[model samples]
Target: MRRFLSLLVFLGLALAQGLSEVWKAVEVPGGICADGSPYRFYVSPGDPRRVVLDFQGGGACWDAATCSPESPTYRRRVEVQELLLAQGIYDRLSAANPFQGWTHIFVPYCTGDLHVGRATVDYGGFRVHHQGARNALAALEYLFRNHANPERVFVTGCSAGAYGAVFWADRVLATYRNAQVALCGDAGVGVRTEDFPGFRVWNPRLPELPGLSPDPEVYQVYLALSRAYPQGRFAQYTTLLDGTQVFFYGLMRGERLPSEATARAWAESALRAVTAPAQAENYTFYLAPGSQHCILPRPELYTLRVGEVAFLDWLRALAEGKTPPRVRP
Candidate 1:
């Protein structure tokens, strides 16, 4: 009986692939962009038992100068077509894609709150709505409503969205209850400065995660989630010297442009941030050597490799409920 059910699922997925899936926009009430515009997320139909919830990362801002769209700090809006344009894991045509026939929920980031803020701030006259948590929650609820009992759920994001992936993985686990939920944070190794604005500015309603500080670090989410969900897999992927991460760290330090010295400092901090999480049995990391930021949304997901392990293979293992060995520089 079980073999017959499995064969039926395989045939269903094959038919889904044969149909050439396209993204469909889902708009929920209370979902709004940072610019106070109507916000909607995109979903692509695929195998009903497998789902991928991806958060789109542009950038983030904390103060008035950075918050201004003119400053080029973060994305203040989202477009429906961006999801269809992304090539890597989202590329349904590629045979190398592990998630080719999985249901995809593309979560666009515009709240500048790392997808976990709840406060609104008026920087002088320009009001910025930091309701990332609200927007993300609405999207998650939509996933819960549509996919009641998935076999697997891949929670992931790049850059700012990577942080979102970690922040929301616990909730995904809670919703699925019986599903194999895995988290992969692409290029969002949370390495921020001491002076970086904590939770006070954005005022996120944090989950009841033990070991998470009042002003939490990115690794805290990793550690907390690993302990909280031992059966679930949690992982991170980042370049050894991520230029964008260094650039953002420089911004927190009041530098308009980061010096080479700042890059070195960022590397050290990033390495230290991964230390504790790396020790977790289920938490793994892939630290490739380069300055490039994100890979999951790019072609590098298939071609890039470290040592003997291809990134695509490692990611496939993670999505399939296997704890792939970590690859580090």
Candidate 2:
């Protein structure tokens, strides 16, 4: 009976808060999932002057094996219930959340293309729509139309969504040209195998970045964005030995189950990727010690720390246009 009473009070407080009441589901006809399902994103009202365009991560697929529905590496559909019930950064009850009370646009990932593909590929007899770029653009178009002018906009994502955030921050800043835009890539670092070049299967419509290598990695995208948007603040967070990234790294190298060497190589590549853009004064990184894949959407967003600097505080500094020192464990 006491537990039930506590739940009632929590519900009453939630009702009074009204965060859940304002979540609007917006569907774009041009957007779609890997399975050709209709794609939709969610938006919740808050201080309209400030906004967060958060990309949802569920991993990625490059070739037929990983793209298979039976494969565990990637998600093929958007789960609305999961998004609506999410905690951590989305937890309005947490006053420590830097994004609390900010208008939120949740961009769901299901296309297995790191939110940059605009193609339909054939895997044996199966057809998968790698329309990530289309879906992301559609969601941004909505943001451009609805929240054109805001004081601040934080573009971020976890895992594959991290890659999404890195790729799309430029577009977001362009839309809100006057707004102070900050970007934080959660965990996805683009470390690909040169020999395989399998990611080409996605046929991503990359931004026409000048001076970028003919074939640029994810880090190059960050570098280009940092240079292009000099006024935008940017940062990245990653665990020293992120298991998910190691797995994907091996997959890119054609190893279904990554070996110890794969993890070592992944660590090296990920470190290089994050540090490559450190020359940009506007960019910094938070390197935690763990195998955790992502952090922004998890409770660790508030509790995790490296040395004396808490991850939450570091992120808050980035969001607030303050330069948080590069942290390494």
Candidate 3:
């Protein structure tokens, strides 16, 4: 009875939060994206313009790497950190400094793993470059078939989620006919309170937080993804390569630089479709100054509590084939 009651409670919250269904509308059970992948899509009743695919753990995709286990490594990468924050430990971290609270939310949006299985497309692992195109294709098809004609559609996640957004834009060119991906804390550049890249990468004033470390192994997954895509998508990148912390990702210094360089070097990379002229006007890149990841890209410019208003402008521009204005903060 307790288990059944818990299940009921869970279902109630999922519906209320609009996680599983929409209110005042026929509940169309979102399938594995008409393309046939085991992923889930959530159309928020609060805002249908907002379609969150629930990747990184919220979605039912078999790609497990996109979300993470109970490791800080996963937090720094893209995983639905809202799950982590519910835990007592994350609460303490929040109590420590609430202003920087979203870092917990933004990181997963950037570097979460990208793995998609089933027919149509199967790369074995998630590659932002490849996954971007695939996801964009899925999005385009869905839009046309559903006839959504939505004013704006944005994909967001923490850590890994953020990374996927950046990867999608960096890898999938043309910005998609009706969408623009925003990779929050895209590369987690200046998120940490302590470190800063280039000129400085550490917060000497504050002691290094124990148990925090970079998971370069995560790069292996990215590298595998990149190797499959000799040609990338976006004309530029918004890597959060801020120097505040080197926990999950970092600079491209010396021989180790090629990997780091890819984030910005995306513009020069190739794309899948041939016969492409210059595409400079299609995309814009923004970097947070002091953080290691996408925790705090431009706080002053983007209101945390304002919800999706700020991002809608850019989304509208991209959807209409107009270049979204660059955000220089």
Candidate 4:
């Protein structure tokens, strides 16, 4: 009986040690969420020189109807404490994940601005704070101060977070001069340049890209990053019939809920945006069939294939500096 009790205690200690390696929620000093709560991020200790920064994905809102306290979109805010306890691809212990053991920084999304909004707007009697850009800058500053040198850095995100990742990739690369960087934006194909005015209120800190229009499309950001970092890698993944992107594009284009035909047209336009950069050697993409929204969070991430190429394998190749094919449906 004593032997069994001793063994049980030993097992308990082992389990606790393993759990300690998982992500822990850390509140950023002076950071604030859209709802006025304190902003926090999850950090799991690993190799300081190798890091994977993942931005949490939730829908975005720009106006009174979407940003109101009672709206459905407002409820999608990510709670960092809850996220630290959940197991997903970002978890270092996930056997299927390639990024295991890398220093993982999970940036939670709650500002409802795709991590780029900078203004506080009044919605009738209520005031909504759109300070995503400031929030991300705080987190990045924290990371840079602590991990002064990084050998390999990957910046990525899904859904709205994907836009955040792309928007911030150049800044991240600039901060770490010698680090080899790669960016993968999943399901963040945004609206056209004509619709840019709606988000222009956010006053995104866009990087300078020569020859592109003053108000370039969102996908154009990827191209600009590519030109800015010729030695770095860039990739995007999405379904050809992604209804989530279609809906957002339509809404930005003045349609509250787009018709099937209208949605298809917008999806096609998004496809063109991604493919244009894929034609460049440093940029690549994987566009599968169906109406699936995001990839990194799905179990299908392990099994989804574009032709004979598995999605996981493709991601692995990209991380290892191999140029994978630009897949299409």
Instruction: Write down the TM-score for model 1.
Output: 0.91
Better of 2 and 3 by TM-score: 2
Off by over 4 Å in 1: 1-21, 80-82
lDDT of 3: 0.30
Candidate 3 local lDDT, residue 241: 37
Per-model TM-score on C-alpha atoms: 0.91, 0.91, 0.37, 0.88
Q: Please tell me which predicted candidate would have the highest lDDT against the true structure.
A: 1
Clashes by residue pair, model 2: none
Model 2 lDDT tens row, 1-329: 99999998998677545634766778888678999888988897789888999888887877778888798887788764335455678786678889889988999899988898878999997888999999999888888888868899999998888988887887887777788999999998778788654457888867666677756788888888888888889899899999988988888777879999999998998899989999998899999998987887787787898999998899999988777999999
Root-mean-square deviation of each candidate, in angstroms?
A: 9.2, 4.2, 14.9, 5.9
What would the per-residue lDDT of candidate 1 be over residues 197-285, giving only the tens digit for each residue?
Answer: 83678998666677687777888889899888888999999898998999998998889999888899999989888766877899998
lDDT values for all models: 0.85, 0.84, 0.30, 0.77
Point out where model 4 deviates above 4 Å. 1-21, 74-77, 80-88, 208-214, 254-256
- The alpha-carbon lDDT assigned to residue 218 of candidate 1 equals 82
Return the TM-score for candidate 3, rounded to 2 decimals.
0.37
The number of clashing residue pairs in model 1 is 0
* Model 1 per-residue lDDT at 121: 91
Off by over 4 Å in 3: 1-39, 46-71, 75-112, 115-144, 148-158, 166-185, 188-245, 250-279, 295-329
Clashing residue pairs, candidate 1? none
Q: Of the candidates numbered 1 and 4, which has the greater lDDT value?
A: 1
